[model samples]
Target chain A: MSRRTTLLTALGWLALAAALLGLAPALLSDFRLGLLAKYCCYAIAAVGIGLAWGRGGMLVLGQGLYFGLGGYAMAMHLKLTDAGPGQVPDFMVLYAGGEMPVWWEPFRSPVVTLLAILLLPVLVATVLGAAIFKRRVKGAYFAILSQALTAAFAILLIGQVKTTGGFNGLNNFQSFFGYSLYDPVNKRMLYFLAAGVLLASVALMAQLHRSRFGELLVATRDAEERVRFLGHDPANVKLVAYVLAAVLASVGGALFVPVVGIISPEDVGVGASIALVAGVALGGRASLFGPALGALLVGYAETSLSESFPGSWSYFQGGLFVVVVLLLPGGLAQALSALASVRHRVGGPPGGRRRRERPASDRTRPGPTTPQEVTA
Target chain B: MSVPGRDYLEVRGIRVEFDGFVAVDGVDLTLLQGQVHFLIGPNGAGKTTLVDALTGLVRATGLASYDNQNLLDRPSHAIVRLGIGRTFQTATVFEELTVLQNLDIAGGVHRRARSLLRRRRGVPERVHETLATIGLTEQADRPAGVLSHGQKQWLEIGMLLVQDARVMLLDEPVAGMSAEERRETGELLHRIGQERTIVVIEHDMDFVRDFADVVTVMSAGRVLAHGTVEEIRADPEVQRVYLGHTVEGVA
Candidate 1:
């Protein structure tokens, strides 16, 4: 497809999604609308995973650290506001007396809370990415390092009951900006905000993917040593992409707390992080729209299946991931490409012969020794 | 013989050892401005090790400088930024990216932050010019991984061209090319050598004879002979170590 046509098609899809979201209040019940809103948050998280894991090849299995940071930030402000001046939130009252934790004091202001949510993840990711990428660590080693961080973050949160509200997490938020969140209109407005943000994030990702920075990201992914030889620091390139992905995940988490009316340790843990990546992989990591579609699909399946099958929903989710992994290693996007290639092969004229093939020795040689190859 | 006016790169007593194994020991070499120099040796004779040291891929013990700046302490990326570029023995073109995208990224090394942030202009044109020079303009939009091996090698060279580096270090540039492709690559290197210093590591003596202005023969981690190809071919030590019994035919 031509670039112009492809962009126009994407714009049309965005417009259709926005129109549907604008009309959702009239069509669906409040509960279903809320579910869709939650899915938008998941879609936002999936987009971040796509950039970090799919394009940059970082395999960031600990996106939950950023997610929880954002969620907890937003949740703390909501709890403090709901408790009125000076009073402690109910969760804090039961968990650790009727006193607000010192760490939670800064989040008393909504502006400070929101800023913290966004800035904290970017700061953490920058430090983490710089440390890891500068060392030239990559592949499975990088994946494990990220996953370990998520586990550590979750454990720390669970241990700090006085400050973080611990396992129960700060919930029962009554109002947002003097508006009752329980009202159907305000709830729908929040859903619209999430959908808008999801669409805008996708558009931003598309722009980045087309730019020169995006090419460098992919080049680093494919061959960091070669990219270094070309006079571009691969660590800096990967760091930029990594930090962007973390910020996106944090935004998703912040929006998620307000839309779902709840935030908990269970939601931002190792399990949730893995699920986020599975959805992106199932959708097609390299494609622009795949992660959003895949996240929404997974979200819908979780909600609908639990309503019908209850205890078996997790099993179904596990099975679906297995099917995608076994049958479509490239995710759903590859199916389309496979079909196109098959059609071309069948439709080509008869008597078209394969070109002459070169000997094995004529192919390029192996890459230079990497850190891993050297140690091994 | 040393050139009267300029030296694009100079190496003095450079030695590279890995895990106590001397790969290239005390190897001194130099390439004058706009000259094509060749490094040739038998298996494990440290030709690639020398290229690695020059490009900053491997650390060396002694003085290695480019344009009078010490290269031993600089990172690989910094070396490239100092107007030195290299191609791997294996083609290092971004496999999933298009040929044009690869060249555009190559040009990005020298781009300012402001220019990099905006829609990249001038890169497409530079990519086109480089592709055309390498005779791969027709395959500009195709994924580089899908190109023929010789075409991929040329595309990599095109990348080095767009990078606008003053010195090019190629590791076996004609390793996998057909005879015609090798001749075309030889002619292309000759043209490039007119404007930039080129150091090529190769096993093909025929290509070396046709392309090299100066040939340095290495064996057992040291320079065995350094002279014109015919002059080196006639050297008794080079004949004994590198050419062996086959020197009579080439001589």
Candidate 2:
């Protein structure tokens, strides 16, 4: 990019920061502000999806696993704080009264909760990613494996009525840390925190996208064999992106607990995980701003559509995903590229020509979600 | 780490058997540094398979050694890191990336992961120099995907240059080219071949005759002939199997 384009992009980011940080809080009501905070969490998760599936070419279908780890870690601390010093959570009293599970004890500390929210998801993702990438399992197989793992995670939470809250999961938080939930001022602070984190995540990814590592990530995606012959391990390159994705999802889920006042299996199951992916795909997986904006739009649409037609909301979500996949798999940018041919992207991918050396049959072998060449 | 005129890549008893079909049967070829070695033979004579075996792309039982490390059994990436590189029959530069970015990524194998996370401050001097070497300085900003076929092939060679490859295994580098492009590529091979070991798996007899310092001929998964271009062309045994057609084709 030229110096002039770089200056304009910096200015554009500053303007967006102003709108998101200053303008949004002043404009929306408390309820609406809280909703936006929720959407920001989803956006955080979407950025990770973009890094993994979009650039790294690893379909991270089980981001909910990381999200849940962070959400539950935060919720555990909040629930423990609500229960006082000696007692277990209220759910234990109703379901199977007993001592606090040894595993949940660590999350009682605010420091531990924070660490868990960051490390737990990364740890799990690294283990899972290492196994999958080492075996070179990818495309639809990876997607299915991730989805199945998340489904199993949801099922495990539902079955553990004594420890976890079972089907209801964790909910009814009275406070976040020492801050009272009822205080509107504190609620606004939470919103700013989420928004700020979302911005920082975007900035961090933008930096990575411009970095040598980012270029290598794209190289590995397009030509894994070619990349291997270049002397850099594609598996290791992909693992870094996958780990970053898990960390982002984990952080998003942690913030989600305070902002939404709940952490539940329903929020980190296959449905929720797919919803996060849908938002990214709807936005434009490869574009920097597209994922976050797409997630916000999808979240807003979900709220509006669900309010009007609560029962038909699932059908709408499914239909939206189908349309995005079948018609516009390139996501919102595919539509926008027509209007603003310059469709500005933070991590403007090296667009033009896929693996030309690859047999034509192999490009579409994995199905519609395959990384099609994006020239624009 | 290489001394000119000494053995660089020593391959002994390298055999590739795919379900009872022996593709590369007991091949022993010692590639020496500072030599433009050409491996020329009929199609399916295990030339490509031999390169694959040496590069660790195929699981072959053999002693393929470089820098005292057994090249076989290690991964393809490891083989590259050991100062060995191979290009496919077709150009395989990352089509989406710019020519500069392609070389940058290829060159970065020697850099630390920590350094890679930061934005590239400026084009590295080595990468910049390589653009001139490959004659793609003007096309550096253009995505490699848009380069002309000959240019793409040069970019692939440029990638090996950036990789600092001590041994370069090129597969039919000038298969389709204008006479001018072929000449340019032949010149490129000469420029880079001065310090490194180059093994060109070629079908173009004229290219082999013009460029090869030492030529090895293979037939039916075996070494049919080995020595200078003149010796192989003069031998009656070589004439019967291969050179009978090759000398005619070139004429």
Candidate 3:
């Protein structure tokens, strides 16, 4: 991109970060801040959905599996930590006769829990994605397979009630890395941490969108056969995007556990996975900021609407999603673009020249990669 | 067309069958380096099927080799990585991506890693050169879906150019092009053929006659004739099977 455009984009990102980091804390109460933190975690997962479904064209309907992986991983460590050094977790004592499952033993160490949070989802996605994509599974079949996986994962977690806390899930956390959760100061800190992580995730996505891998993933999405003819294994391109999305979802889940103080099948099921996708779709799946912002908007709307109309808020949310999708298939981003184009039309001929002349300068000139040229 | 014993591509006994019906049955072909070869046939003559078999897009039992490496049974993308590039009968540019981005992806496909941290430096010199070559430099920033049918065709061909494949397999490159576009594409193929072996599957007899260095005529899943364009034109069997109803009549 031209230096001016790059500066503008950077400034825009900074403005967003400043608003989130500075304005939010100064304005909101502790309860509201905590809610925003939970929303931020969902937004992080939505960003991953945008990458996989929006750009890579992989309808990852089973992100909950990875999300649950990270959430459960972190939850186990916290539960063990709460139970103290040599004792079984309280849930195990209450439900499983004070016997910790062998699998849960590894999460006793904080370092191991963190690493698992980072690596376990990526590993699962790699194995599953490689197998499915290499065999050339795609379209609705792939979507169904992913959805089924999420359903099965939720079922397995529910069925293992003695060890998994049944449908009640893991909760009642008292500390995070030694900071007592009861302190409002620590709660605010956790909110900042969540915001910071969301910002970092956005920055990471921006970097990937400009990278060659991002371009290849988009290309694969558009035409897998053509990409294959270009000497790229489309499966590999898709697998990378899938695995990246899994890691992002996993990280989001890890953060979710501490922020919400709960990890349950309800939060990691086909319904949750589709809800995540709905947020991305509403935000404009292909856009960088759209998914995150869309998710946050959805979360806000859900909470406020439910507070006002407790029983019927879900119908309102569903109706709004349906209307946005039907009226503007490209989501909020498409609506914004359409508005801009309309303004351009009304504003006169000068705006027209820019679009027309873009190809000449962009094609013939040797210059830096333009952000719009890459991502758009 | 003999220099020494070096063959650019060799195919032996390729056969493709689906549910007890043979599409491409027992075909052997050879391609020479830096030449324009055309494979022409009627609608159901298995010409595209043969290309599919050669490119590993279809299940085929045979021995096929490019640069002394066996190609049979390899995956389609693996075959492409072995320096074979192809275009579909239908124009298949990435519709959402711009013309330049489409070419850029094709150019960057062979790069060692599609890294997250490392941005592609710039549009490669070759990509820009290809835009000019295909006469689409002016439309490079436009989304490929907005391009006209003929423009999309040129863009796909431009993609092949940027891919830098040793062998280019173009399936119906000029199938739906206007007369002027076809003429331009013929010229483009002539220029491109100077560097790489090109196997063009075309229905346009005039294009084949005007531009082909070698013509392989297929009829019902087998080679009816394989010779220079003139030799194929002169052959009675090719005339009866493929060119019999032509106005020009293979004169």
Candidates ranked by lDDT? 2, 3, 1
Pairs of residues clashing in candidate 1: none
Shift of residue B106 alpha carbon in model 3, Å? 0.9
lDDT (Cα, tens digit) per residue for candidate 1, span A190-308: 88889988988888887777677777777787787888988989999899889988998999999999898877777888878878877876787766777787888889888888888
Task: Evaluate residue A331 in candidate 2 and report its C-alpha lDDT on the 0 to 100 scale.
Answer: 86
By summed lDDT, which 10 consecutive residues of candidate 2 chain A come out lowest? A359-368
Task: Sort candidate 3 into its docking category.
Answer: acceptable
Give interface RMSD for all predictions. Answer: 4.8, 4.1, 5.4
Q: Against the unseen true structure, what C-alpha lDDT does each candidate score?
A: 0.80, 0.85, 0.83
Give per-residue CA lDDT, model 1, range B1-251, as digits (tens): 35433356888898999999999999888777677999888888888888888778788888877767888888899999988888889887876667887888899887886565555555466777888889988887766877988998988889899998888888998987999999999989888789898989888889998888999988888998899988988888887775553442243
**Candidate 1 lDDT score at position B171:** 91
TM per model?
Answer: 0.91, 0.93, 0.92
Off by over 4 Å in 2: A342-376, B1-7, B243-251
Backbone Cα, N, C clashes tallied per candidate:
0, 0, 2
Instruction: Give the residue spans of candidate 3 off by over 4 A.
Output: A1-8, A350-376, B1-7, B114-117, B146-148, B243-251
- Please report the TM-score between candidate 3 and the true structure: 0.92
Higher-DockQ candidate of 1 and 3: 3
Top candidate on DockQ is 2
lDDT tens digits, residue span A1-376, model 2: 4578467657766776898899999999999999999999999999999888888888788899889998889999999998888878898888886666789888789998899888898789889889989889887888899999999999999999888888888989889989998899999999999999999888887788778888888778778888899998788999999999999999999999989998889999999999999899899887677788889999999999989988887899899988887778778865775445334322345554442323342332221243343211
lDDT of 3 at B99: 90
